[model samples]
Target: MGTRHRDEGVTMAERPLVVPNPNDPRLTRRLKGLDQDRQPVLSDVVVERPLTLYLNGQEIVTMMTIGDYPECLAVGYLLNQNMLLAGDRISGIDYDEEVETVVVRTERVTNYEQKLSRKVLTSGCAQGTLFGDVLEKFREVKLDRTAVLHTRWLKTLLREIGTLPSLYLVAGAIHGCALCAGDAVILYMEDVGRHNAVDKIAGYMFLNGIAPHDKIFYTTGRLTSEMVIKTVQMQIPILISRSGVTAWGVELAERAGLTLIGRARGRRFLVLAGSERVIFDADAGEDAGA
Candidate 1:
């Protein structure tokens, strides 16, 4: 099932798998307060609430999110945690908004008892927790190294995502991740945490049967190992961020042969890994201020 509730933003929520609905009143709140100078001030703040996820009969994790895409968030969390295999057939996804709970049922006999016994923490905010040895699967993923990310496509992508009417621009405390095919965004998701944003996209992709080989992942958050692992898990060829990268993230990208780009804003970006796939077809003056 798709997002049960949605409202049109300036341009988001129009097409694509999903996009931020900044105009959705439930996602934010209007608070009345006074400034330091004794002036009346009204502020729009993001609404963060608990969302508990269940894979089959077992509880997976309870994530704090903006509460729009509960179904995607639930399924994506299980997949990102490696609790749900990509080949696993999902029977149904049940979401109950009143209790803030979502359950994902599968046709295959699902079990993660051993995997659940181990938990690993990483640098991706508090939401960056994973179960068992993700590296075991990480090592086995052979990314399509032949995929290319053209400089011209990168510039267009930066411009497209930056100008999007999103919750980050509407309110201050939020994170966004986009799934792009070439320079065009196919899905743009946002939430209280960057992990939630990316996971929503992952769930959407899985449900829609979208191929990841030629896709690029973009994020407003830092390039942490969590980001690298999630992008690699999706089998996307390129990962770009308008923020800096962590050391472990770069190491993982190098190992996976994933094109990792960071500090991508206004015509300046650094490719720390898999530079062989970047085709520099654009000049410095072309979209220089993007």
Candidate 2:
């Protein structure tokens, strides 16, 4: 449970909480598996459980997550789905770890029976799912045009992200997302699904009052229409990925004027849209060097 924040204020994290730690025993479990030599070996696997979310006493959705930052994920999921408005007042949040459930209480009454009637299978890892109604808002949302990214900062950002400890490195079965301001990582989240990770970051931004302009959203998953739409909804102008991009994702990015960069491994990356917002300050040859 949480205390109530003023109408214009945000409820801060009551305790010091660390998330996405690969070494967290609660999040990872050791299991027996066969190695390349066919010998039985102990392996680490990321733990996933059903996280059911409730909004104002109504069951919203059940998500498969790695059991971290459920509060953020719940709020972000509702926000991105358009079930929660920008001016909505959140009275409090209750998270039950044992039941693996989170309830978001808002002052305003909400319902999404019709929106939930339509579902779309997204192009995200862990078989991501999203509401079909997000399309209309996706088309109407416009990101800040003034946001820009420096090529030099991007190269460094990718290298740093690789070095950060992640569930993917420890268990090999998770996706990660990070919020960055000028190449510095602000928040990092990982879950069974890339959409979950992005939602967690969105929740963090909403609760912490972090502005999206000049911020970069990075993911280890490919850029898909779902990803593009969610990034734009969060008001983040730039998106980066270590994977490739889908055609529909590119189209949405172009429509929203979002800077989309993918294949950001080492120093090589392809800018699929909004190249005008990027400042190529790095030396051409330096991008190829160690």
Candidate 1's error at 251, in angstroms? 0.9
List of clashing residue pairs for candidate 1: none
* Tens-place lDDT digits, model 1, residues 59-169: 877888899888778878877878777777788898888898899998777777788789887767654787667878888888987789888888788888877879988
Task: Give every collision pair in model 2.
Answer: none
Tens-digit lDDT track of model 2 for 158-178:
877877878899888888898
Quote the lDDT for 151 in model 1.
86
State the C-alpha lDDT per candidate. Answer: 0.84, 0.84
Q: Give the poorly placed runs of model 2, Cα more than 4 Å off.
A: 1-19, 284-290
